[model samples]
Target chain A: MEIEKPYLLFLGDAPDALAAKTAQGIVDWRRDWCVGQLRLPGCLADTGLPDLDIATARARGGKTLIVGVANAGGVLPPHWAAPIVAAIAAGMDVAAGLHMKLADNPEIAAAAAKHGRRLFDVRHSTERFATGKGVKRPGKRLLTVGTDCSVGKKYTALALERAMTARGYHADFRATGQTGVFISGRGVSVDAVVADFISGAAEWLTPANDPDHWDVVEGQGSLFHPSFAGVTLGLLHGAQPDAFVVCHEPTRTRMRGVEHRLPTIREVIDLTVQCGRLTNPDIRCVGIAVNTERLSDEEARRVIAETVRAEGLPATDPVRFGVEAIVDKIAEEFGLP
Target chain B: MEIEKPYLLFLGDAPDALAAKTAQGIVDWRRDWCVGQLRLPGCLADTGLPDLDIATARARGGKTLIVGVANAGGVLPPHWAAPIVAAIAAGMDVAAGLHMKLADNPEIAAAAAKHGRRLFDVRHSTERFATGKGVKRPGKRLLTVGTDCSVGKKYTALALERAMTARGYHADFRATGQTGVFISGRGVSVDAVVADFISGAAEWLTPANDPDHWDVVEGQGSLFHPSFAGVTLGLLHGAQPDAFVVCHEPTRTRMRGVEHRLPTIREVIDLTVQCGRLTNPDIRCVGIAVNTERLSDEEARRVIAETVRAEGLPATDPVRFGVEAIVDKIAEEFGLP
Candidate 1:
């Protein structure tokens, strides 16, 4: 029922969404199950990631081709569908996180069926959710709230989950979006819910019965964003988190889809904290997570150091520098051994 | 086809939800379209609403029995099925706004089907929504926000809508919850949406194409409410209203389902204005709509007088005194004729 071994391919190109998260997840976390990546000639050449043809990929123990890029709008372009069809024809299964499922598209479905290839539409989880009561759930729920939408909230949350588990603290990643679903294979896409039940949807995702466990609810939107701020607040309220990490991409100026510039990290933290108090007054900000992809290693560290100094919280590039500081902060607050 | 004439029944019970909003709506706003009321035993006696048995209701020009009263959990209680069955057997079409649809239950569905009676589930409307891009919508939006959930947002908005039209403004009521939908027959329940798409759902409902038309959005939940505040913020962003009216239930000491006390009228107005500016910086709070249901008419006037004097904006019990003050405020702000 599942592809045990797979050759992940970007095929044509990768969108800037999720910051190439799907590809990186397969490459770094599931590398043992990965055969190698298959890309067009000169495509993804300089990244030092493995680039193989469909034939060579299968020859090196690949059983399927998992298309890894989550492009903008999540639609599989007509041109890219051909390459995916070619992979199915080459006797390998194909998987994608596109919003348009291959199983739903007649052309892709026919090609997939003809080759008897398995398809994985990892964009959304089919979990039937109950209404969220926003009861006091046990086990230190922590969420990664961001300064803007898509500013590494998921990335840092996942990294912190890994770091926490690495330090022997039991933690889990609750996926909020498709990229998170592709990586974790779980979580309700909160934004897709009907407005009346958003809080209930949040309650359903992280129920109120455990004291010794931690639920890392994935955050969505930004409090400052004119368009997506509601989702941001909903996730904040839904999680009812005990502690949180403020995720920020330092290079951005204006908020997405709006004319206003981004709020200061302190302002975002203050807004988040103020909003969090609406549900739980004791909620705390554990750390600051800065996305440093645009900066050099030295610059990233300097920016993080400055953020830590200003915010009076431990700060880090969760992906580049690891989430140990933030994880440790959570562990200390929750009295994890 | 809509039923030309119908009796809207609260059925077995009228829960506090919507403050029996479904029944009150028919009696208050849609009186011309309503035939009479049907209740089980001693319910709804003092309201002077017409209480009719299924047979008598039919004789009195009732063609359908609408199951009113959005019950606590929106579930139809077991005992009410008998009365509903009697209505169906009487050749009366039944309509309900419960989350539990009549068509979903075998007993109710079969009874209605066998009797050739129609069923109307008016609580939910299915609209394919697009992601809110946070773009500037063209028309001016005026939302009625509240200090607590169910204080009087919909009622105030509806009254303002009437007053605006009476004054020759191109105004419309955009309902955001079930009661609003029952009254207006349109609007997406913003709370039922997935977390990420709440803003989008709002955007899809009010597309950005008109400048002269004004949308009086019926708001849900207070920004401080623990149970459903996210929907409040989402509606704010989705509507991106240029002006707002703060609705307050002055007698509310504590917020719903929480230990937190309600904020002051000034605080509520400030918070609504601050959050509204997240999407539209020029957003303004035109006036206050006081829900003086707990106060006597004279007492209500005194409270309104006190509020208007203190807040320096016109304040009124919209249902009793009408929304002329708030409507005039909106009219002045937008330079409406």
Candidate 2:
């Protein structure tokens, strides 16, 4: 949201289904700054922003061209390099979360250097993490648990952290993914790490050194995401959180790239608690953090109310209604000042 | 067991307790080819071999001085280098399991070069591991479980692999530690990897691509060993073993270097199963692989008998009784040839 200039999201060759992820995330989460979006031919008109080509978008005062997809394996598709280079030449700063570096390519490097434009490689990390060791450090942790990957986990964590801080609590946001890393200026991208060290990485990020502070640890993939469940388990064990907030996108019908339908909110909350208590027997799911981006504000509130009644857990649409209710609940439960 | 030349174990300034782990392991496991033991002032005398200085040991036909301590953090102690260099100058080869390599130090490198002696850095590995995507691979895995660190996990694994091989089963020993790396000449050191990648290293070592083979995956740290339990869980998950054999040194009164008493054999078996079943629900603890090195033969048999009777698991000392009973049980359970 620190975007000082209007932007164009370049979704090169990303199929129609994935447009709702990174591209639509910008439109839904940070929409005000986006002037337009560029997509391949015949892709769905989901962004709702004006569609513009590279030259037209630049002329329309789109000073930043964002590569709006964190592709699987985080590998940058080589086909997008040409359009990105042209954007740099047109004096637009470029940003991508892919593992491949624009600085490594000579053509893109020279153009960016000539235009004095910056390229932000979001996924490359320079942090070292020690073993978690399951140390009983002071302070309680509030980890955001998710029913699926990218289900407003970071957004909810940041929102809760902000709300807690505003209410005069010593709260810290612990990032666990690329976007979170960019926002926080520091974090380990838990997904990019090797399998065994997932818990250790999570443990390093959310150290419980102060009894009064709440470390709002961001969640990564979910217990149901087939490709990323191990990381979920690792993070759960490593955090050893005293309490958790379960996150879910209510509109989603199935887990990503699989045939199975999504589990009920109650089932997911129970599963999240079970997974967390595997390493931390004292962990409890305190409430639900619902992602209602796809629904109207009125519908979001309805869904939130329904979830709270159905699961008998306090639930909130933090993005819509603010996180104070959930924050106060946590403060009351943990005796946070 | 493959030593063609008489060896001297150099326990340079190592305390008695740790020396018993590595030096006595060499004496007890591969004792036939060793000629003497070397120690500095105030260091313990646990090796029970003839005491010899550098020149005397070399003159007495000790052509290789093995560094007999795998220190915590795998870092080489600085004081050990001088004696190691002196031993190399006296026509002895160098061997060490420390993460810090004597071969990487220019002074030691020059000394070894001038003496035409080889420097063996047992822990510095050049292997890469892929992520262990939870797939039900073809082969049945046989992982060694342990009651504590350095309680003969690798020894049990190697012994079982050897026995199975000798009996004409297609068995492979997949090592996960420094000593096993030296014995095998190749392996990813699972402990040295960052917290997230332990399981991937195990998977890379024991690819279950052939259903007819029995992959004997070497265990690293124990499930209850505080500092390294994450690694044990990762290896177990990565191996996805159908059956496992527990490795225990009956004399271990406490978990290594920790105040907690060792878990009973049955408790450890249950703990091992629970930890492994975190990723693989079907993993079973099939039998017990005992290390009777510290006990008299009669006492060793008594402990083994007690464990077998109490736990209802077949038990054997692969060194004293050979691994036939355990191997035969595995073959029968899996209906293997």
Candidate 3:
């Protein structure tokens, strides 16, 4: 599902900044793709994009209206339909990150049909994927795995793409979640796919590419996470990365949304390689990306230093320090430019 | 999804016995639950049950008409609809093992609504499931883990259930696939559920039972299978079996539908234990269940003996030899009467 570029983000009466997290992610990663933001009255969220009406967004060459804000229940309030319908009527395609489909709303569906515009429900996949073949496809892919959920896997992957590109390596961030999907403009939300096709959908997302070209694939739930390990394992098999970075959160005691204690970074690496070798025998952990948001700078550095010493791999917080060390490790390991 | 008992098996113009495999499976496991078979003209399959028309089958206390045959493309032919509708009109609920929903056919939908009957598409899950919590629940569970797809996992679980029950244990066979659902008369086809809910569906299928009762959970794809390890892992976590049997095929060299070597029985046991330990800390392998259909009697005995020596556990072809050894191992290990 290739979404049209230069999107006009719709933040329809979202209550807070977290509600506009998807839009914020798009702005953070691909700010150039966003033309502006369109907010409904009483909307408290903002991505700091220019405020623009439908006609102004169209005039400014916006091709798609992205419903990036998520309200309670991921529902599209009845009052929010007016702006979406207006955008479609103005000949702009619409994409949404909602629990319900935009096409399920009659006004939005009809307006898109009448104006020859497309409606993409990014939360739900309409794409049919074949079961994963486990074939060794051409391409040097690097995936970010985590010890638990809500780690820095996605951020580390996006960072790797940027840093690897600067080091004269061809790289792209392949997304597997809703926010990453908008940032990359196309990707299957693996969690939303039918259970049997989890690996197949991941295979489709990052296919055969140039041998030296790197697909910095975003990861999902950790292999240790009982709630979502299936999605993580499927992504690992389908991506079949030659190199992977283990992402971790240093402060969390238990896994998110469950009673399970967090697995050590070493355990994550061992299990990933054990399972990942089925598809890519040469798979290895290149580095570690730790989320140190709760730690002070000194503690973050100390923890990262201990992790690096313990695992014998480069480790850093991607947000505070760039992933240059990880990129260097990749280059040395994979013989990349 | 409690399907009413006393099924009327519908072999609708099936060209061969292989096409009616689902019906044959149900008859093999639950002969008493089947009233009789109903076949259309030119049908080539028979389950050895007495033939009866829809009215006669209903009169004989058939509560459900199981469309338990697979045609090319899994589509319901137009001619097959008449009998299904007739059965519904005769006041029987209809359940199908087809790819498309029974209600998708307008004629069948109308007939069911008019008669106040229900339609079940066993291959598709309409049930809502919560995410799998890694919490240990009350039950003695045994799961069948395979080295590859179609390696007698379901058959092994069913065999264990029957043998254990006859030995004075309260054991139930929990279904995870389409045919097993038909045989058990209720289950969510786990593969058809959304990717995030694979484990959740498994948990629901084998909820907390009496401490001494066993839920003999049927497993799906292999943990070594690159194409489907995700499903296997999720099932392992969700089932949280206290004991598991490793199912293998003696003659298969490669994993099904993929170009990969089959994992050894040792590999399957180790991986199942490593992953299964997350939900059930005491998880361990009790035996090896081999499919010896391709072997002679002497060869089957030799293979089973070799497996028993190598794995140091009970091993047998459940179909040819019986699961008594495995049940004995379980009873001894758990101190069951």
Cα lDDT tens digits, model 2, A1-337, are 2223577887776666464366665566457778888776556545778878889988888887877765567666677778888888888988666767767777778889899987766554445555556656687788988887768888888888878888888888887776565445457777665444566777777776778888888987666543455566678778878888889999999776544456677766776665455456678777888888899989998999998898777898887777777877787787768
Off by over 4 Å in 2: A1-130, A146-148, A166-168, A190-203, A222-234, A248-281, A289-312, A315-332, B1-129, B193-197, B222-227, B248-281, B290-306, B316-322
Question: What's model 1's TM-score?
Answer: 0.75
Write model 1 residue lDDT over B1-337, tens digit each, in one string.
2434656555466534353666677567667666667767645432346776778888877876777665567888888888888888988887777888888878889998899888877554445566666667788888888888778888888888888999998888887766565566556667765556677777776666578888888888888776677778877877888988989998989887666688788977887777877677789889999999999999999999999999999899987888888877776778875
Residue A207 lDDT (model 1):
72
Per-residue C-alpha lDDT of model 3 across residues B195-250, encoded as one tens digit per residue: 89988989999998888999999999999888888998899999999999999998
Report the interface RMSD that candidate 1 achieves against the true structure, in angstroms.
2.7
| Superior by TM-score: candidate 1 or candidate 2 | 1
Give the lowest summed-lDDT range of ten residues in model 3 chain B: B71-80
Instruction: Give per-residue CA lDDT, model 3, range A261-319, as digits (tens).
Output: 99999999999999999999999999999899999999999999999999999999999
List the candidate 3 regions with Cα displacement exceeding 4 Å: none
Alpha-carbon lDDT of model 1: 0.75
Screening candidate 3 with a backbone cut-off below 3 angstroms (N, C-alpha, C), the clashing residue pairs are none
Instruction: List the per-model TM-score of the A chain.
Output: 0.79, 0.70, 0.99
TM-score of chain B of each: 0.82, 0.72, 0.99
